[model samples]
Target: MMALQHRYPLALAIAASLLSGPVLAQSAIEHHVWQDKRKFEPYSRTAESITGAIRLSGNNQFATPGSKMTITFGNGKKAQLTSVGASWRQWDDVDGKKVTAEVFKVAKDPGTLLNGNTLCGKAAKYLVFHESLSFGASLLGVAVFEGSKEPKDINSPGLCGTFNYSVD
Candidate 1:
């Protein structure tokens, strides 16, 4: 009887573990893979809106002389930005080195043309930036993308990552 009593607890524990195994393995929430909806164009400096090489200056300001940055909205409207002086900042990382973003000013205001667009919306002027030479998982480095102050988030619905550029 003493042996059987000890065996009873052991059997109970085994049974409890077996019964709870399936329950513990099951998950209540469902997960799905996320997909990006927007399309990206390749960078071509030849005969492109921006024809000149973007060179960084010692003063932290850069210029794209004889070149213009073309921003095409989702609605098919476009805004051209001259190679006016721009600012730089150390943001993001590539190959363990800090990535610098050179933000250029828009040449002119597109007015209502930029209002209520699918990407970044409603702005008199847009901020364009060139990323340092760096590559990531599946995407290569050295490109230009849209920047916005109001939205702030890099992955926000704004016009970020819409453009692809290569610096000279």
Candidate 2:
């Protein structure tokens, strides 16, 4: 009986490893679709036109390469995607009007934020503009779940907050 128990765990482990392949493959395909600009459906020109870092509500510094963000798709689906560093001009006075502005290139196409296959859902259809102006240094958006019936809106607290930004 003892020997059987030990072998059962090993068998289960092997089976799990084998089963993970297709899941991983699907993740890869989803990520590829996210990266392909041609696959994106138009959401908002005003939101897409804005250029700035996507600092999560509590984050102090802007999202640089390797920063992580969590995205929730309805139906109990969630994903965490990493930011990849992209070049943009440093913060400068907007129109030299005393207001400063900087560009986070990834915000131009939120899919560029996917670094690996952590985004596992029914595939994101639109990167919807969610909110802005929290912590004075952040912008929030959502990857609308494909086929979802829920309205696109700022539904997650993780995406927006009024507390002071924290550096971690």
Q: What global local distance difference test value does model 1 have?
A: 0.38
Q: Measured by TM-score, how close is model 2 to the native structure?
A: 0.23
Off by over 4 Å in 2: 1-61, 85-122, 125-168
lDDT of 1 by residue, 88-155 (tens): 33333223344333344455544432233222234444454434343532321222333444222233
Worst 10 residues of 2 by lDDT: 159-168
Taking the tens digit of each residue's C-alpha lDDT, what string does model 2 give over 34-92?
22212122223322332112233222233354554443321223335444332222211
Per lDDT, the best of the predicted structures is 1
TM-score of 1: 0.33
At residue 43, give the lDDT of candidate 1: 51
Error of 2 at 105 (Å): 12
Error of 1 at 37 (Å): 22
